[model samples]
Target: MSSPSTPAGDLAFVVRTIARTAVDNEGAFGDLDAVAGDGDFGYSLARGFEIVLADWDTLDPGTPDEFLKKVALVISKRVGGTSGPLWGTAFLRAAGAVKDRTELDAADAVAMLRAAAEGIKARGKSDLGDKTLLDALIPMTDALEQRLAEGGPGAGPAELAALAASTARTSADATTSMQARRGRQSYTGERSIGSPDPGAVAVAVMAERVAAEWDVRD
Candidate 1:
């Protein structure tokens, strides 16, 4: 909001927002996952992020990369099931993208997101059109990067966030017709076609939350 003042501050805000979103939407997420998966996605994510919030004051904030790595360690160790490794890897890769950078810009943001998506793709052995989170995440990142590149009208932070959120939502909704190709949902075969991928929906929801609160975040 109002252009981030510091890299550390921006990372703090985004992480806190993500953690809180996970905690707050546990029931909805769990219900979504139950359609095809084991229904533990929300539970696992909330449990891990709860620890993140509980230990917020203790997490290193000396630098953006350091903070993200610390968070990644916590996620990998505390989160259960597949969510742990995938999400942890995402944070780790994002941290690497900004390694030693004292400040960040729009390009840094794009790079971090790209790194995170690649990490998720590798860790989950999934890709776009796999009916996974990447379905939403990658498209969202591309939209943001493209918008920034175009520098079109209303290409500010809030607008870019809104664009990303919208793209993620659209992409997630499109997963409803796609048969699952990865994760527990794949076991359901055609049954997974009617329902959206929980991970994709989760990504969309988180992006939406971030966009809606972008201007108001401290």
Candidate 2:
């Protein structure tokens, strides 16, 4: 139940969480993507994480921004297809938003999420309700902001992250009924209605991991 309080620990947690998720749920994501996409989304992300895992020890323990930039570069280079660049851009933008911060508080997390959302939208030319990962991410950010606003003056990162995870999961599930308006799935139009976007599910999984791994801290 130990929680991360430093830049290196935080970066390590993200690496471990994503790698574990890729291992446990890659096939599931592939199956979901097959319904509308090329069925490689899962494999692509997993490969990116494999690169991340291989170079884990080399990741910067200095600024959070540097650590995230390294991860973003790995994803951009190792992962294939649109997801690679878009996800990489998201992380890169988020890292820029955080600048040289050594540790993230609730506000820093929210800012990073906001920057990530904007990055995804710009990189993919998509937005909320687009039946993409943005669907889950937008609602998750909204929920986190709401939680931070309503959790009173002493609002903690754990509660905000938990709310983000819950919102992401709910939004991801709701994507099953949505029609694709962006990405490879858009070619299917209404055919994507029954399957949740794999990217969205991936986002939800990441959020869930963050909540589970760091909620004990605050």
Candidate 3:
């Protein structure tokens, strides 16, 4: 089960890699929403990532599930917004999806992403058309599953990660035309237009970092 394919190492590596990338881009996301949003998203995410890493080395979780659960605690505590709980739930659910896996394959990767989408939807009570992270996540999940079902074309974690990143990027970019139907921007209605949602942008960051860190290709 567990082997080079699984790539076992410190949980901190996962947290730090994703957090650092998200931290760098979080501020830009806030910049896009400075006019309407509280503009704290960038700092809040960075803080959460920073805090999540503090205990990374101590957690020798046997599976992605355990690691995600720990990250959920930190994400909820570190970030003080709707995003905190939403993302925390997504991560926790994803963790649960792979709890028993000693090694993760392309299919396993897709399962994690699908679980993440369902988690966010269940927790946030948001749907696909309503234009939240779900907008980005659902399509990305679909793409990954589709790719995998096609016999995967010499796929591995690296290829799967790349596909996820591409899917996330396209979804985030597509959000420009979407109206905010949930979260902090929901209250704004049409005012939410033009500016992309912070959560959607963060999804791209999260996907990219996950791919880069987990990519097994030399």
Expressed as tens digits, the lDDT of each residue in 34-81 for candidate 2 is: 988999998888899888878877876466788888989999998899
Look at candidate 1 and give me any clashing residue pairs: none
Whose TM-score is higher: candidate 1's or candidate 2's?
1
Best-performing candidate as measured by TM-score: 1
Expressed as tens digits, the lDDT of each residue in 1-218 for candidate 3 is: 12333344433354567777767776686786564567877777777877766766665545666777888888988887777888788778888888877665657667877998898898899988776778878988998888778873556556767788888888888887888887777788888788667777778777787777674422
The sequence of per-residue lDDT tens digits that candidate 1 reaches over residues 29-114 is 99999998899999999999999999998876557798889899999998999999999999999999999987877778889999
lDDT for each candidate structure: 0.89, 0.82, 0.74
Task: Give the Cα error of residue 181 in candidate 1, in Å.
Answer: 0.7
RMSD values for the candidates in order, in angstroms, are 1.9, 2.5, 3.0
**Most accurate candidate by lDDT:** 1
The superposed Cα distance between candidate 2 and the true structure at residue 121, in angstroms, equals 0.5
Where is model 2 more than 4 Å wrong at Cα? 1-3, 215-218
lDDT of 3 at 104: 54
Tell how far residue 86 is off in model 3, in angstroms.
0.7
Off by over 4 Å in 1: 1-4
